[model samples]
Target: MSALRFAEDWNEADLSAVHAVLVRSYWCEGIPRETLARAMRGSLNFLLHDAESGELAAYARVVSDRATFAYLCDVFVIESRRGEGLGRRLMERVVAHPDLQGLRRFSLVTRDAHGLYAKFGFTPLAAPDRGMEIVRPGLYLQSTSERAGT
Candidate 1:
């Protein structure tokens, strides 16, 4: 195996590799290919690729204005490649990227991977605070139908 590689930006060529990693590692149930394609175009994504094979191993993204705060999302590593520190390496870049330094807070929502995220200084929202989503009923239903078709 080769040392891990990191890329701060991704292009069209990298999307399929990244989608495969996300699907295999995350079991990302309902996300559309178009959505992933759009996210890859965001300016603040951090991507880690396998150095020797150029396969995407893990990815973390931040949505920021280059000030104030940032949200970290979609952090994952391929199952066959876990326990090798690629997730940590990907997060180190996400947390320490020049544009993200000195943020007031960085946050994420995870259903189960709390232990993995905690190592990078992420913690649950304190009492009196909670995460909430304003679901768009139409979009939610549409995505559900699309996912069922897949």
Candidate 2:
């Protein structure tokens, strides 16, 4: 974590830097800038920066009520910074965050990185049959078009 800085304030992060990184992420491809800005406004965002360069190096956000539940999402590390272990440090800060502890449920969805998350106690849904969702993959593609009036 040398030469790294961590921040939670929305005003401290560059909105365009975040949007640019996210639009390239597998999970958030084509996500609109305004949509992301709105989501950040409502969520608890964790950001890592290069202290020397002032660049956004990694990020993760959690949608929580500061109570019994939290949905961890949008976890990403800038590609140029991937091998530096920023991802692990980001999760370390998230799971240990004061508001996220002792919850009955702290959850996330990851197409990969299971091993990293498992080290922090995330697991396969104990009851896959018990969990359900109204997943709408690529649901944002239409929105992008609509916003463009295409």
Candidate 3:
């Protein structure tokens, strides 16, 4: 296995590779590239890649005000590269990012992988009753043309 490198710079992103993984992911299945691109632009992104090959191996994003609130999402390690601790490495970077410090709340939604986040002090909301969201299931079920607003 080749060594992996971590990068927080969006300038080093291989967006096509990231898109391929995300569109196939259970959470973002069929997500439009345009939408993903916009979301990436609006958030702070973390990336991991093969130091030698330069292929994107993992990714995660955080939407934050850098002061009091943040939402972590779209985290994943490529299926072929699982068991290499890449996800944990990415999370370590996310957790230690200077821009994410001192937040009153840092939250994430994960259908699975609770164990991973647990290692980073992420826990269930202390008050689920106080949390609310207008979730639109299947919001990403759109064709390229529609998703791109063409």
Q: For residues 1-150, could you state the per-residue lDDT of candidate 2 as single tens digits?
A: 559999998662478889888887778788888899999999999999999998999989999998999999999888889889999999999999999988999999999899989989999899889988887666567665664668
**lDDT scores for all predictions?**
0.73, 0.88, 0.88
List residue ranges in candidate 1 displaced over 4 A.
23-28, 128-131, 136-150
**Tens-digit lDDT track of model 3 for 58-101:** 99999999999999999999889999889998999999999999
In model 2, what are the clashing residue pairs, if there are any? none
Q: Estimate each model's TM-score.
A: 0.79, 0.91, 0.91
**Lowest summed lDDT window (length 10), candidate 3:** 6-15
On lDDT, who's better, 1 or 2? 2
Cα displacement (Å) at residue 42, model 2: 0.7
Residue 39's C-alpha lDDT in candidate 2? Answer: 97
lDDT of 2: 0.88
